[model samples]
Target: MSELSSPGGEMRLDKWLWAARFFKTRQLAIEAINGGKVQVDGQRAKPSRSIRPGSRLEIHKGSLSWTIEVLAINKQRRPATEAAGLYVEDEASREKRQEIARERRELGGQPQEGRPSKRDRRMIQRFTGRNEPSD
Candidate 1:
């Protein structure tokens, strides 16, 4: 069996999160753990906490959350497809996340695509009563 799928292996929570693609970097995972955005078995966990297969994790990031059970341990970060095999997210969590995403899309308040054009900037300046020397 691959080391990643070894039944009794243990790995640091932060390293696992990074390898599982939950966070872009181990530092981010550490920060989230310290900030109380990550929990193990419904209790706050430290970045260095050792986790094994079957450990339940609760992670909250912005408007999305995940409740998942660890399925494997990977020491190195992997592609998203492979990373996904490390954990199994709860069905309610998945549905809630999708519903929130759909609501955000339907709300129709997308941010401005990019920096405003010169004319657009001028209009904004005028509307906000903040005029400056024209370029």
Candidate 2:
């Protein structure tokens, strides 16, 4: 069997998360775990927590969430396609994420592109009844 599927191998939760492509870096994964944005087996976990195959993970990042079961572990980060083989996402969680994404798309509130233009600022001020005195 390949190293990934080798039995009895375990890894740090944060390291695994980074290797699995869930976060861009191990530090980000650590921060998420510390901030309670990540849970293992329905309980909050530390960055150093050991995780092996079949461990359940719940991760929340802003409006997105994922519930996944670990399938394998790797010691180093890999390409996205390979990382995806590390876990299996629950079908309900997949559907919920898709629904949330669809709803956001339908809502269609485009984010403001940078600092608002002078005219746009004036309009906002006027709407908020906080117009500044003319310079």
Candidate 3:
């Protein structure tokens, strides 16, 4: 009775995303899905796509990415720790994230989280040997 008869009784992409705390609102999840930021089983997905237990989700948000395997489906959003229980992160992706973060740290931590001043830019340009900087 749960196959074709379940009106998404399990979970949908947007709901899962919201419940998983990836997005603060279902609408945002939907938008992200429609914008191709959410992938189901390695293919791009829509917000209303039905998701069952054991499904894989690949999510991209700006510089962040996650690969999670669904273990349960819930309609309501849960607390952080509770929401975290719904999926197992792909080991490779986790490792890749860590590696990328480490590389970013070694590369000096993501642009200082602010705009660069002219002096900063000049200093960087000079230090990196990009040009003679108009003598």
Estimate the Cα RMSD of every predicted model relative to the unseen true structure.
3.7, 3.8, 6.8
Give the poorly placed runs of model 2, Cα more than 4 Å off.
Answer: 1-7, 111-119, 122-133
Clashes of 3: 0
The digit string of per-residue lDDT tens for model 3 on 10-87 reads 777898889889999989899899999989998988788989887888898878799988877766676788778778
lDDT scores for all predictions? 0.90, 0.91, 0.81
**Model 3 whole-model lDDT (C-alpha atoms):** 0.81
Writing each residue's lDDT as its tens digit, candidate 1 over 13-113 gives 99999999999989999999999999999899999999999999999998899999998888788788888888999999999999999999899897779
Better of 2 and 3 by lDDT: 2
Best by TM-score: 1
Give, for candidate 3, the lowest lDDT window spanning 10 residues: 1-10
User: Which regions of candidate 1 are displaced past 4 Å?
Assistant: 1-3, 110-120, 125-135
Residue runs of model 3 more than 4 Å from their true location after superposition: 1-9, 112-135
Compared with the true structure, model 2 gives a TM-score of 0.81
